[model samples]
Target chain A: QQQVKQSPQSLIVQKGGIPIINCAYENTAFDYFPWYQQFPGKGPALLIAIRPDVSEKKEGRFTISFNKSAKQFSLHIMDSQPGDSATYFCAANPNNTDKLIFGTGTRLQVFP
Target chain B: IAGITQAPTSQILAAGRRMTLRCTQDMRHNAMYWYRQDLGLGLRLIHYSNTAGTTGKGEVPDGYSVSRANTDDFPLTLASAVPSQTSVYFCASSDSSTGFDTQYFGPGTRLTVL
Candidate 1:
């Protein structure tokens, strides 16, 4: 079974607007949630990550908001730009584990 | 750094054939992983090795196999090629000594089976 579920197969946002992608996991054992960004033909790269111990984590224009009790998390892209358009994936990791459970994905398109 | 490198950028095989996808890392990472990426399934781990000579099966390991012969190499093998096995394969490595850390992925190898 897929442990993590992501919403909005695709998203479109105007430049300078905020774009959000939501995800939820069934396993409460997950301790780390990381969001990845992938460009066409490229592997996904870490955009931002948040541990369940914290409510949120922000770096540059990317922010990860995690709700441990709700078994949910989201990635918010602030001031969306054309270059920021890419596929976003949400993943979960259990403590001391090296493997990650990933969500389907959300393709973001920011219009100029 | 060369990071992780997966050989044969892409491959086309027929059913009943045996295929192997090669992965090498220059980072000397103790952890290596093989994952398959599909359109709707995101990325699923097939196999992983925490160190050379030891391997573990991940969520989707039914059709795949992997081996970590040395610190720099981890190869994923398909004993019998099948149509369903066609997908982009990615190899990744991470420096776990710094704590469960970020993984660096390779460009990926696109495979098609007939």
Candidate 2:
């Protein structure tokens, strides 16, 4: 099983439109959730992260909606821009483990 | 300023030969990790070190060995290369805690074995 399952493997959204990527996990012990963005020919970089204590966290145009009970979390990009177009991955880790289990990945295309 | 440096950006190795991928971090982070990326699959941890002298296995550790003799370097060695070992390898470092620290990644090394 893909510990973290991401939907809409490929997405297309117009500039200024909201682009959302969803991920569902099965491990209840996972308390840390993070999102990473990778451009072609580059390694994955950290975008944002959330702990189980908070329901949501927002930083600039990016917001993470988290549901503790459902074992789910999502990344919402407001006013999506062309520069934001890249492969996004959602990952999770247990309370004590430093290793992260990543999702397959979502290729987002923001059209102008 | 080098955050993390990986040697041999790309390499081709013949099966049964030994090869080593080198990684170094100047940040002096206490923890370092190795991960492999493959098509259709996400990053999988290979090995890690919490400090200078300690090492541990991660998600996928087979056919690989790592040594952390000093704080600046962590190298992954493939005893015998094989076609199944072809993949891009990344080195990452974190400050201390798992939840509080963000891992910084290197440019990556692409290795192909045949």
Chain A only: list TM-scores of all candidates: 0.96, 0.97
Tell me, by TM-score, which candidate is best.
1
lDDT of 1 by residue, B7-37 (tens): 9999999998999999999999999999999
Candidate 2 wrongly placed segments (more than 4 Å)? B97-99
Interface RMSD to the true structure, each candidate: 0.7, 1.3
- The deviation in Å at residue B101 for candidate 1 is 0.6
The 10-residue segment with the lowest total lDDT in model 1 chain B: B95-104
lDDT for A16 in candidate 2 is: 99
**Candidate 2: tens digits of C-alpha lDDT, residues B81-111:** 9899999999998887534477888999999
For residues A20-90, could you state the per-residue lDDT of candidate 1 as single tens digits? Answer: 99999994598778888899888888888888889989999888888878889999989999999899999
Query: How high is the CA lDDT of each candidate model?
Result: 0.90, 0.90
